[model samples]
Target chain A: MSSISLEVKDLAINLSGNQVIKDMNFKIKKNTLTTFLGPSGSGKTTVLRAIAGLNQKIAGKILLDDTEIQNLAANQRNIGMIFQSYALFPNLSVFENVAYGLRVRKEPKATIKEKVDAILKTVNLQDKEQSYPENLSGGQKQRVAIARAMVLEPKILLLDEPLSALDAKIRIELRNQIREYQQRLGITMLFVTHDQAEAMAISDEIIVMDNGKVQQQGSPLEIYTHPQNIFIAKFIGNHNILDAAQLRSLGVELAENDKSNFIIRPELFQISITGDSSDYMAVSGKVKNISILGDRFEYRFITENGLELKVEFLNQQQAFMIETAITFYVKKDNIERVGI
Target chain B: MEKHIDRIIAKIVITLISIYLAAPIVATIMYSFAKSWVNTILPDGWTFEWYLQLITNSDFLSALARSIILGFVTTIIAMCCFLPVVFYANVYDESIKAKLRFITVLPFTIPGIVLVTGLVRVYANLPVPQMLVLLLAISLLSLPVTYQALDNAFIAHDFRAMFEQALILGDSPIKAFVKVVIPNIRVGMFIAMLLTFTNAFGEYVLTNIILGGNYETLKIYMYRLMQSNGQASSVLTTVYFFFLAIISIIMIAIMKWQGSKKAEEVEDTKKL
Candidate 1:
């Protein structure tokens, strides 16, 4: 059997008169949670919708297990989708909502009940079988939506910002539950979210998108540490990006032909007063601003050469005041070269 | 003191408007039971003789029955034509709704008399049944009310998501619509039907001019009696008014019930 569960090749979509997605390509390994992370209007949701057959693509080949499904209707594709809105049928009880697909497929009443009951149990919503959607909390409604899609045991599932409408605590709780279910069921899942933190927390692989194009596709840590371009570097994490001129101003000597931008994460900068500059590229700067970021203190530091950079340090009992002189160093191995 | 004076003036204005609107209906109700109402501020005597006569008359009963049939048929036809169009506009192609704006203004742009005149000119020499033509015409005229009420149903919920979810759950488009969409929008459909039925039942010019006396609807019978028997006509008019009042009451009751249900749903969510 093929290890890849789903793939898209040379996809292009034009909505109305504008090209929304252009030549998009990617593949999902079986049973892995891959997230399309981007800012809003980056076409992540549009790409997810196109894969689910809810959107029309002007040119594309969407394959499931290496078989083309781009021409299939949405229902025939057997692709489960959980929308941002839970989209539970208001008139149907929880059990009925989950059993709707089974009932539509003409399954026996006993089998439908068994499947719905089992799926509801999996989602920890067994007690909510008789409850209507209106009576459930947002978290509970989303559980029912997931159960409704999972009852059919689809080969793959698409979740389009399903937790975006939820509260912070519920979003954290539900995303963990989603990851657990994906692993337990071994279902290939494509998650679309504009939240970088949520995507990093839940995804096995992250495909960062910007302006309807894929910027980087890799493991969450890989994408974070080795962003393919300046956009990804800035978008994925709060990396301090320095162009060649800025690098030169920071007293960093570059090769004659080396003209690449350098990216160093805010958290990777080590602050010290006694570190020898020989072992690391060190810059002396004064703290310009301090921000309390819960567990970390983010200090905006301005070097003597007028290069502004952000450096994050773990919160400690002692605090540094604004305008306090500080020296921060980045190891040579930690700085990454990226494209514009 | 100025605020107090403003409140008093507002109350007076509301009271005067109420009286202005209710005076005619109040007088008609009194006149329906009056022994003789003219040349006096109040009736000299009260009786149910007009009511009894109207109830006993076969023509009045048949006319009522015909008007009811007309209302029902026109409602069905109008729903059949407009429900799918409205659902498509709301769910899939919202651009179609922009083109449908002209239907809301149809009655104003083409009055019933003018519409009937055109219909007679076109279909008079044809072999089609005039009653069917009248039913279609009444349905077309009631489209504005039906369309607006149906459109209001699409609000308050993410129907597109609900529908697409159903489709992904192994339902064909039609099955998804019938299974998911219709149940959610049934209340709105009922409201649209009620409005359309009321418009058709109370339709005067189209029915009278198109079918003449062949189809003597309630309004036509009232018009006939209006020319000869003043007391009986008043009684018929009062009955018609009560019929409309009952429909209005039902509509209001449904709206109140729906509002309470929504409040209960919100309360339920809060409790969780």
Candidate 2:
């Protein structure tokens, strides 16, 4: 299997006289899945389309295995794309839809049949071989879409929020199925989605973007734990953002003087009934609210200075009263400084 | 009980409307078959003599052939010219729909005699034959029918996405259009052809006012019979209705066969 590396350097795009993507850059190593996670109009879908060569008038380089493809047509680029609608040919049967790419390439009949059958089985949709798109459920249509694109075995696959149209239950079910296929085939894949939890769940590397620019790109854990900026910190996880002046006044050292924003993860702060001396700084606050999630509990606290902080607790053995005061401690190392 | 009452009322209304619409055609058909029914409750004698006159008339036969030729020619030209135009407008400029609607309804507002008169002057200097000019005029008259059919097809199917999907699948744009887009919209195209052809076939005013006796069509031949044989004109109309019914049945059969296939596919998917 030949794994192709993808690189987009200083890429920019303007649609109808408006700058939609501005100086975006990213690279994907071979045989890995990277997701562009952002809100709508954040230029994530446009970047994916640019890489797929669907959008013209894009500036800068898009390289697949050292070959510049920005000027190439979509067909010449050899990139597979699954649209959000699944865009299955409604007239064709599942077998025929999967066989479309090979048939168009003028592969022999026997080869097309063999490849299509194998892919249908991989998607676990072999029983729907003779079924048209209208005859299949939403989940089945999704599988057929993946099978159609992957059967071509293009250099890279780009998916534009393929699961956004599905319901919650099928979305999660098909999500794992896609990850399994991508890993098993070792194909280079770039998936775009606006759902943060979905990005965290399936992405090997998540590229968080906002305002038509890349905010940060790292492993899911790294993005959760070490968000590089204030936008990313707030976007990725529920973190208490406080002024560096408050931390410094509380006897914590400053990383830089000009940047005043610091972040602490909600789960990193430990809350207790007693305000005891510890290695970390301790602060007391009154419990404002407590919310019970499926497997965890979140507590909202308001300090003496009227600063609110959220702390999460997995073990809910100690029930703190709503108006009672509790002390929450955080290590100095858990404090992450971020730029505005 | 309320639902049952509503169903009965709807059935009664539909039956009443059907009879109201069918009454004129029934009277005309009975008149053509009557031998002599001047003031009686029904025809005193029924004869096939008028029908025989219609079949034996050479002018009428030639006129029927001419009308069929024009129908096929006009419908074919309309479809060949407008499919791509409709597809382009749909994909590139959606605002073209308003323009299309305007042009489609324009022919209806202008009297056919007026429209044909304007046409003769415009082509007065052209070297084209009057017959060719007539065909072109009729095609233009039915342009909206063909264009609307294709426009509706494009609206129903997202041809842009299908085209893009085909290109990504390694087919050229032309190939994708020919193989995928055309087949998907084939039903709409067939409907367009049939509608335009039917309009061109029954057209009387354009053919009568411009081409006149020089190029007599089926409708023109029927008009000529009104002077000499009023009963023959009724016979001609009855025979024309028969053929129309046959053609309608065949077209409906084709549409239903294809339509049911699609419907079954949808229901099957639902069952899954």
Candidate 3:
């Protein structure tokens, strides 16, 4: 069998006179966890649905393992989908729910039992065989949903914000568990989430989407450290954006009328003595506010040009005093040039 | 203190209304068992003689059987017919679904008498049997009600859940309906069945006009018997009341079970 890879080319979807997804394109390698990250209404879920053949009337081709699946119905596409709600069959026992796909294909009862048992074990839900879905915990329900979809041995597994409905602690725990299971099975996985942190934490490749288009797509660290646009910069993590003109006035290097936005991460700003710049891009500012956050103190400051900046300092021993004049240094390499 | 007094007065008024609503059924039962039902504020004697009389009457028995059988059959047919239409409408598109919903409930908007008159006109031309015509009339009368119940049930369900379950499992729409949709909305289904059955059983005007004194359903039998003063009529009324009460109790029990099951499911999910 050919390796299961997914490619979407110039996909466009219009629903009720509104173009929700426009010319969106991406590719997922076989046996890798790829995530589509975007704010709500940014068409992340729509893209996933389109690939799964849940959304018709799309103007593009979706290829799975090099076969065009755009015309296939949702069931015929052989793509597994775990809904944001977990979508476990509320009426069925855990085993039956997991074995649902196999049962539908009219597999032998013994084979269904064996496959369900193995999949349940994979999801660490072996003990929940006779338990109904409503009796499963949020994380357990998510696991059952994953098991249910994966048992079909689908070409690709699509998870639409699976951890969003979960509590915080469970979200973290289940995220790791899902990643582990996806890796172990070598299944091509496409995860959708509005949460950038969750996306960065689990995905092998992350596609940042905004306004029905791909903002950026790269490895987690690459996208986080080198955002291609202001939207991706602000969306992936907290970043203080400054105009290129403002950075040039502060004696930072600039090409003639580059006119691009400069993004500096909050964590990259370090407080140092004005005279001890040490080959770093330094700017003088007055600390306007300081707040304690466990092991670090986050300081908000105003520069001479009336621009606001935030810096996170690792609190060593003393509390940071408010209204203190501090010189903060941002490494030149850390300042990423974003969209014009 | 003045506001509290107003609240108390409102409570008293509501309680009085509830009691007033229950008074008719209590009076009906009392009159059905009363040995001397006339010229008295209350029964002078209570006995099961009327009930016994109703059981032995062949016409009354046949009417009762016909009513029950027609009620159940209509309910089943309504469920089978309405579920697919509702499910398909809900799954496909919203605007079209809304139009379909309006059409399904069209029978309810038209007054029952007006609708039944139209049905009579249509039935008059057909060469169908009296029993089938009666069944069809009763079924049409209860159609809107059953449709509404099942439609509401379908609306309340997680469509994504149902669709995803079916899609992932590779199950056909029919299997999904049987296994997932039906079990999830068992309460709504039960209520629809009971309401449809009760409505069919008690319907008089359509049965009367359609049967035209030829076929006597339970309601027609009761109406004819009530016209002629006899203890046998009172007994039949008592039997009918008892049967209605039993059905009502069963429906209530089913609803309660459904509610409890849902609560238990919620609690179990929380525990997990």
Name the candidate that leads on TM-score.
1
- Score candidate 3 by DockQ: 0.59
Give the poorly placed runs of model 2, Cα more than 4 Å off: A1-4, A245-257, A272-279, A315-321, B1-20, B92-103, B108-114, B126-137, B155-157, B243-270
Best by DockQ: 1
Per-residue CA lDDT of model 1 for B63-161, tens digit only, reads 999999999999999999999999988988898888897767777788789999999899989998999899999999998889999999989788899
In candidate 2 chain A, what residue range of length 10 has the lowest lDDT sum?
A270-279
What range of 10 consecutive residues in model 3 chain A has the weakest lDDT sum?
Answer: A270-279
Tens-digit per-residue lDDT, A133-222, candidate 1: 989988788889888999898889999999998888989999998999899988899999988999999999999999988888999999
lDDT of 3 by residue, A3-74 (tens): 549988999999889998888888889999999999999999889888877777899999998999899877
Supply the global lDDT for candidate 2. Answer: 0.85
DockQ of each: 0.87, 0.56, 0.59
Instruction: Write one digit per residue (lDDT tens) for candidate 2, span A1-340.
Output: 3344898999999988999899998898787889999888899988988898778789999999888999988888889998888878877899999999998888999999899999998889989999878778888888899899999988888899999977889889888988988899888889999888889988899999999999999999999988888889888889988897777666676676555688988888875423435557676779999888857888898877677888888855776769988788887778887888
lDDT by residue for model 3 (B1-272), tens: 99999999999999999999878767777777788867878879998877777778788889988778778887877777766777777766545776776776776788768876787677778887767767766776787777777777766557656765586567666666787777877777877888889988888887787776776779888888988955666666767778888988997888688679779877766665
lDDT of the structure predicted as candidate 1: 0.90
Which ten-residue region of model 1 chain B has the weakest summed lDDT? B102-111
Using lDDT as the measure, which candidate wins? Answer: 1
